[model samples]
Target chain A: MRTFFNTQMEVLNSELIKMGSLCEEMIELSIKALQEHQDFYKEILKLETQLDRQERNIQDLCMQILLQQQPVAGDLRKVYSALKIISDMERIGDMALDIAKIIKESPLEYQERLENMASATVEMVHLSIDCFIKQDLSIAHSVTQKDDVVDKLFYQIKQDVIAGLSKNSQESEVFINYLMIAKYFEKIADHSTNIAEWVEYSITGNYVGEEE
Target chain B: MRTFFNTQMEVLNSELIKMGSLCEEMIELSIKALQEHQDFYKEILKLETQLDRQERNIQDLCMQILLQQQPVAGDLRKVYSALKIISDMERIGDMALDIAKIIKESPLEYQERLENMASATVEMVHLSIDCFIKQDLSIAHSVTQKDDVVDKLFYQIKQDVIAGLSKNSQESEVFINYLMIAKYFEKIADHSTNIAEWVEYSITGNYVGEEE
Candidate 1:
């Protein structure tokens, strides 16, 4: 039974990594779709569906482990944190799709600041999931700290949008789209921080985030 | 042991209701702050902190229930749903605070469209929690359906903001603030629908909404 539980946990961890990879792909594609002015909505929608299935599967596995294995303390926290982590990850996927949808509607010209923000957010997503898979507290803390960078970029983007509007160089709708996209990326960064916090919780039983 | 579990479950349910009520109050206060152009950030922050404590207490209770009682199947689902519901509730609190923060930054004049959207969102929050407390499938479904209204209102508000911009009547920063407020309300409505979907899942074991 112990070995079985361990194997199931391995499965859970791998499944999470798979879901995390999909999220990375989704975020990348969303940004690429915007940068290249390609229609990526269908692909993003497909990825979102896959993520939903992954979430449901992982949720079922977590419940089954709790019910069947009756894991105590540490093991139980791992399962619980997995459950929580996937929900955040699923939200990340949704946010990526949301960005893609916006891109589809209003494909604004690429801005260097927004691109830099997107890259930072993407890196955060990668690092957060890697930290979780490795149970690396240092990396988790780093992800939390990196959220400040995303926040700064978001404010900068907001300023640029305002400046563009004041100059009347960009149409209101287009500039608003840029602001929305930047805001969505900021939200994605927030969700990545959430995942990293949950990873810390799984290891130390301490949720270190805004909620605390 | 069964009786003890039942009692604890009762406590959990009541705590959830309490948290849900706080969410309702937070939404109302946020809208009121905007409408009256008053500083409600401190109050919203207070409510958010209370929500965090409530979430921690409820999560601890849930873990205790699962660890001590070893609830299975339907009983387990109830506890799990409670766990998921609180996360959404906490987020709802955070989003309300986000709206309040924006209101603090740029005090836009009261617009009827925004007021109507805020009222609709508040009602959705109320109904969603009410559905969870009562396990009312009809009310839950109603909340899910009502999200369309909020979405429509969001688009209308977007249009209104654009119109304001085209007429060069409102400052770009001010109109952008309105857009953000509307988007936050739309997100709050989404969270409410999520709560309602969880309520349905708890009662029927069938998840609904976009994730499925």
Candidate 2:
């Protein structure tokens, strides 16, 4: 019975890690498609369907483990964490998809500031998934701190857009589109931070996001 | 033994439902304070600490149940679902607190259109929480359809802000503030949609948030 339970727990943990990898890949590929202005967004969109399917799959697997194995104590926490992490990962995937679609539809010229912000977000996503997969509390802690970096980048982009609006009204429409895209990117990183927080919770069994 | 497990499960369920009530009240009061520009902003800030405390209490209780009870299949699912739902509720609380702070620091001189968007979101939050409380699949299903309402409102706000930029640059800061706040409100609704979808999953044990 102990071996069976251990195997089931291992499967659940690996499955969640798989979902985490998918989320990271989608974010990276979507950004590359945008920055390169390639036709690769089609691929990103296709991957989004995979994200949707994987979300349901992970949730189902966690539910099955919780229902069939009747996970106890630490095992139960792992299953619960999988369920929450999957939801956050799914949203992170959606934000990436949204960014990819925006890039695909407009294919606009990228401003330097927007490019920097997008790149910073790409790095943030990479580090976030790394922390999740490694379960490195220090890496997770670093990801939390760098959330301010993404936020600062976002603030700079917003400021540039605001400044642009004052001097050049003709480009403001295009600017707003870029701004929304940047906002979406910031949100993607925010969701990644959320996943990292879940990783912390799974380890500590405490709600670390709140001031407790 | 079964009776002991059932009692623990019951406590977890009821506590989660109570936390849901706090989440609903926070979202509602925060929106009301913003829309009315009343002195309620201060009161809403006070509620944030209370909401955080409630979230901490529930998670601790969930930990106790999982550790001590070793509940079976159905009961374990109930406990795990409570944990997942409370996390969502806590995120919703964060969203509301974020919006309330935005309202306080930068008072909105004009927000009729933004208020309309918030009103739609207010409706969505109520319906979504109700779905969770009642475990009503119909309500949960309806929430998926209405997600686009918040999306549309977000788009409309973005367009209005961009247009306002060109038409009246003087109100640009105000418009941008409104845009960001609207975006936050839309996200709060998105988080609510997440809860409703999870409620669907919990009741039916079917992961069903995928676009179909």
Candidate 3:
């Protein structure tokens, strides 16, 4: 029975890494499409569906573990944390899909700040999952720190968008869209930060991250 | 043991209603503050902390229920759904806080569309909790429908903000803030919709609501 539970736990860990990679790919492909004037909405939508399925699959597995196996206190926290983390992971997919739609509708040339924001957000997503898989406290902290970088870039983009409005109010629609785009990327970072906090909580049994 | 389990489930139900009420109040107060040029930051902040505490309390309670009681499948799903719903409820508070900060920093006069959006979102929050408490399927479906109204008002607000940018680019920051404020309201509705979906899932075992 112990071996059976541990084998199932191994499946859970592998599935999480798979879901996390899907998030990274969707984010990267969406941002790449935006930057390079390519279209990836078709690909992103496919990935989004996959991510959704992943969430449901993981959720069912967690419930099965709870019902079939009597997880100890530490194991219970890990399973519960998995349930929370996957929700955030799925939101990352939604954020990516949102960005893809924005890019598809308005193919604005990618500015440097927006690019920076995208990179930081993607890195945060990457590191968040890494921390969870390895249970590395330091990596989780780094993901939180990366959120500051994403925020700074988002602020710069906001200022630039406002400046663009004065120079050419005709593009006001696009400018406002740019603001929403930056906000979405910032939100992606925020979700990743939440994931990192959950990772910490699973290990330490203390949820230190402030409410998202 | 059966009696004790029922008693604990009752306590869990009451706590969820309390937390849901806190979410509704935070959103209503924050929107009211924006419209009336009053500061509810202090009050809303107080409510937010209380909401946070409620989340932690409810989460611990749910875990206890899972660990101590050998809940049947139905009871298990209810406990799991509570775990998922409280996260969304806390996000409603976070969205309210985001809107409150924008109002405090910029103090934009509320427009009718934003007002409509706010009202729809608040009602959605209320209806979501009402539905969950009653386990009414009709109310859950109505909550999903209300999301459309909030989305429409958000679109109108987006249009207005972009138009405002043309008239006075100097106030672009505030205009963009209005855009974000509307998005936050839309997001509050989205979270409420998620809550409604969880309610449906708990009752029917079919998770119909799409990813957030």
**Top-lDDT candidate index:** 3
Q: Tell me the DockQ of each model, to 2 decimals.
A: 0.47, 0.39, 0.65
lDDT of 2 by residue, B1-212 (tens): 56876776677667777777777788888777676775456676677778778877877787677667656555665666676667677777877877787778677754677777777777777888788778799998787778898798788878778787888775555666678788777877776787787787678766556521
Give the higher-lDDT candidate: 2 or 3.
3
Summed backbone clashes in each candidate are: 0, 0, 0
- Give the per-residue lDDT digits (tens) of candidate 2, residues A12-45: 7787777777877888787677678765677777
CA-lDDT, candidates in order: 0.89, 0.74, 0.90
Score candidate 1 by lDDT: 0.89
TM-score of chain A of each: 0.96, 0.91, 0.97
Lowest summed lDDT window (length 10), candidate 1 chain B: B203-212
Cα lDDT tens digits, model 1, B1-212, are: 56998999999999999999999999999999988999899999999999999999999999999999999987888899898888888888998999999888879887899999999999999999999989999999999899999999999999888777766733888899889999999988998898998888888888776531
Q: Which lDDT value does model 1 have at B153? A: 99
**Reference-based TM-score, model 3:** 0.97
Residue range B1-212, candidate 3, lDDT tens digits? 56989999999999999999899889989988997988788889999999999999999999899889857688888999999999999999998988888788879888888888888889999999999999999999999999998888888888888788888888877888888888998888999999999999999989887758
Candidate 2: which stretches are off by over 4 Å? B38-42, B70-74
Clashes of 3: 0
Q: Write the per-residue lDDT of candidate 1 for residues A1-212, one digit (tens) a residue.
A: 56998999899999999999999999999999988988899999999999998988898898899899889888888998898888888888998998888888878888899999999999999999999888999999999999999999999998888778887833888888889999999999998999999889889988777631
Q: List the residue pairs that clash in candidate 3.
A: none
Q: Report the CAPRI category for model 2.
A: acceptable
